[model samples]
Target chain A: MRLRLRPRDDSYYEMFTDSANNLVIAARLLVELMSDGADREAITEKMRACEHAGDDATHAIMRRLNKGSAPPINREDIYQLASNLDDVMDSMEAAVDLIGLYGLERLPKGIIDQIEVLERAAELTAEAMPRLRHLDDLTRYWIEINQLENQADRIYRKLLARLFSGEYDALTVLKLKDVIEELENAADAFEHVANTVETIVVKNG
Target chain B: MRLRLRPRDDSYYEMFTDSANNLVIAARLLVELMSDGADREAITEKMRACEHAGDDATHAIMRRLNKGSAPPINREDIYQLASNLDDVMDSMEAAVDLIGLYGLERLPKGIIDQIEVLERAAELTAEAMPRLRHLDDLTRYWIEINQLENQADRIYRKLLARLFSGEYDALTVLKLKDVIEELENAADAFEHVANTVETIVVKNG
Candidate 1:
């Protein structure tokens, strides 16, 4: 196949990469939130910045798509991809915000596993966005994301049961659950991004 | 403008109406759950059946879409509408299920206000679906839904503040929070459905 260069369409790939890389940063900040003696205020501020950056990146994609020049791929896939990435950031940022809002400290130790899974998933997603160009050798990306999501689901349910296990007071459990739910939502959002990529690949391959 | 005699396309309207009507029923079931001696187990089971019926209606639309005839509205609009309605059902059902799972009996009185908002939103959504054919009078539907959503947001925040008001024990607070969160999600999903309808009307009209 000849390499037909589409210069204008190339930036969509770059914007997606930029957007996903923002998630990597936010996920790391989420991990930081789990750290003892972590400056949560500062980390939350940084996470807010990352989320705004993500919003800007998503808007850039939308602005480009709305300019009416045909994209390199299906328009719906681009919209879905951008929206899913934004959703992940929103959930991550929400998790950080709730920690501040509820003045919660000393979270359950089990949630570190949840935050780490998000970090790994973000890493995997960031690695996969650039692969959209070739649309080949991409099977592993979505497959791994699916596996990660299943792992996330298990971790979330276990945490839920533990929250009800009478270890903590009701108020503490309430606050912790809010933060955990947001992390779970972010993990679910990551899988949505992968699904969009899979749809693009299966259609174009 | 004269209507095209697209007889086969008319059922799409029916399916959407059916789907929206199912929300109406589910929302009403949500209301019943709050009543005295409401048979919590029975209502959850009924809510489950309602959710399954909602899923079938959604699948029927998808099946017809996959049959490859062009839909009366944009294909994306059909998908967005169905998916949004399904999301509302999922949240409603999840709310009821959590009530059973947590064995929660006395909810915050404020939540009754929240449930009523969702009930009204569901009713408005069901009424608006049949109007998609002409796409008229829907300006009121979306606007009212937006207002309802704002109202729902207020009700949700008030409830949140109350939960943390140091009234209930921590464990009870945690359990009630889960059920409240799902109801809040249902209201948000109703707004999503209205947004989809607005998109269809604005684009086509």
Candidate 2:
């Protein structure tokens, strides 16, 4: 068997780690934004900053991937991973921004459950990024992310049922659904990142 | 410059074309579903089948990309293109399914504008996929798609403002927003697919 040489610059991995770290911050901010008596404007501004940071990190990775001859992992895997990570940040930012834009004073019931799932998923993703080099223990990261996504899904559906139950005004339901769906999208994006990592691992291993 | 050998199986391009064609049918169905006195169940069922066909096409392209030694385009581009195309289908399917699930009889105003944009975008995508091999005349395809997506975005924002204007009941706003947002997503997905194609063209040209 021919031996494959490792990539010269490991900066892509570092960039990924940076992006994943930003996601954790964004997810946490999302949780904070949902809490009572929170400053919606301040939290959303912070989340927007986090998203911008995530975008820069993703751009850095893409720049290196393009300038360099070969990536440490498959080039496509790097792109997909970076894009998905950015997507998670974007979704979080959108949710937070929607809450602020709608001027929602109160969050609907079941949102806390979704936020919990998001926080755990974000934390697990940050933990998994560093292990991309070896990828041996990364299976559990993705498996767990998949489970968290399912948990988020259940909570999302429950929240939807509540929204349509006539408890909230139509305008309120509209605002809350936008926020909840974005959170669900973030959860799904996290799963996409995990799945990308798994694909990279299988190819490399 | 070294000459690169083209891929042996061109089925991937054909598969993309098939998927894009399905989007056209779905878009047409969406327009049909929005018309008065329409059979919502039958139309949504048809769109769901189109989505499944799109999925199958995407899977076929991916299977070939994985199994084959090389693709006609960059492997990552191929994967992104396939995945984004599938995403457009998913978003369209979600919008249609929501209408059925919500049992919404009357759609909010400005929906028809969104559908028109989607229909044009879908047609343009169907026109663009086959040109992946030549990488010629694709710039306009992506550019037009971007414009169409912007159009869809404008319509979406207008619809949102209308939804929150107290014109509809709270439950009605909830249901209509879901449907409109999915259409907006489909428009975004089409732009993504177009952008991927443009990137592939730049790389391979």
Candidate 3:
């Protein structure tokens, strides 16, 4: 791949790299939104920014897809890849958006714990993205991503067991569970991306 | 695309379609497993098969990726697409696996309701995958998929509120909530595929 190009001629790697960078920022925003218990309006505004930035990155990939030449891979596949990556941010923002929209102040211990795990997973994902620029190095971070995903799974399981064994009301059990699941799903998406990156290494390398 | 290939060559799509078809069956099995407490071991075995099938499909896509050839779309993008679709099955199977592994023979009404919604979502997804073979018809199912996703979201919200409102024991609440969240995540993945397909249509049309 040539380094010099017109503004619109950036390589596919650049598009995905930008998307990955946005994911890191979104992850950080999520931590701030939850841990700090920001005001509803403020959090919502931040989430909107996150969603917009993520969506813009997705569109950049789509533009590459629709550029009317052979993409590096299948167009539909690229579209899905871009969209799903954006979705990790979309889903996370939605969770935070709801937390604010629902006026959920004083986050629960279960949720806070899940977020901590999620933040760690996001950090791993951010680290993994930079490696994707060099496919050879992808394997290095791939295992770490998987480990983060496994850790997330364990946390999710423990949280559920605690929810069931404790004395909370039925509705509260449901709410906490939703919040935790969304966080887990966001982490799961990161794992999916990791899996995608791993496949790239196995195939392209 | 020319349909000029051996059964072995088409096996990827065949197996892919088969895995999706199994989604509906697995979901129905989930419903029955919930009702027929007598066949726990058998149902567990079947659920494992579903998980394995999903893994196989993921591997098949990776195999295609490793061949150093482009899929119908970009190679990297297709890898991500395949991984994301397989994940729906993986996640759903995990829920069923967990229920049985944890000996959750009897679940609360709310949890069951969420599972029912999940079964419907899976059915819709099963309906959607075959349409992929016909590129032109992909967008037709988007509305139905979006509707099911939205419905699942509503049920998730209502169920969680009930969980937290003090209807069940804390521990039980925890378990049931986890189950519900996994089911919801399964639905979320389907919605994602639908969104991807919709984008394909809008761009291609």
The two-chain DockQ for each candidate, comma-separated, is 0.15, 0.19, 0.16
lDDT of 2 by residue, B53-133 (tens): 777777778779778767766787788888999999999999999988988877875899999999999999988878886
List where candidate 1 sits over 4 angstroms from the true fold. Answer: A1-70, A74-83, A86-158, A170-175, A194-205, B1-10, B59-68, B150-166
TM-scores of the candidates are: 0.67, 0.67, 0.57
| Candidate 1 chain B, poorest ten consecutive residues by summed lDDT | B1-10
- Give fnat of each prediction, in order: 0.20, 0.20, 0.20
Best by DockQ: 2
* Model 2: CAPRI class: incorrect
lDDT of 3 at A77: 48
> After superposing the true interface residues, what Cα RMSD does each candidate give?
4.3, 3.7, 4.2
Superposed Cα deviation of residue A60, candidate 3 (Å): 20
DockQ of 3: 0.16
What residue runs in model 3 are displaced by over 4 Å at the alpha carbon? A1-134, A137-205, B1-12, B97-105, B110-113, B161-166
Comparing 2 and 3 on lDDT, the stronger one: 2
Measured with C-alpha atoms, the lDDT of residue B164 in candidate 3 is 81
By DockQ, the better pick of 1 and 3 is 3
- The per-model lDDT (C-alpha) reads 0.84, 0.80, 0.66
Model 1 lDDT at residue B91: 91
Count of clashes in candidate 2: 1
Angstrom error at residue B58, model 2: 10
Ranking by DockQ: 2, 3, 1
Which regions of candidate 2 fall more than 4 Å away from where they truly are?
A1-10, A66-68, A143-147, A150-166, A169-171, B1-131, B134-158, B170-175, B195-205
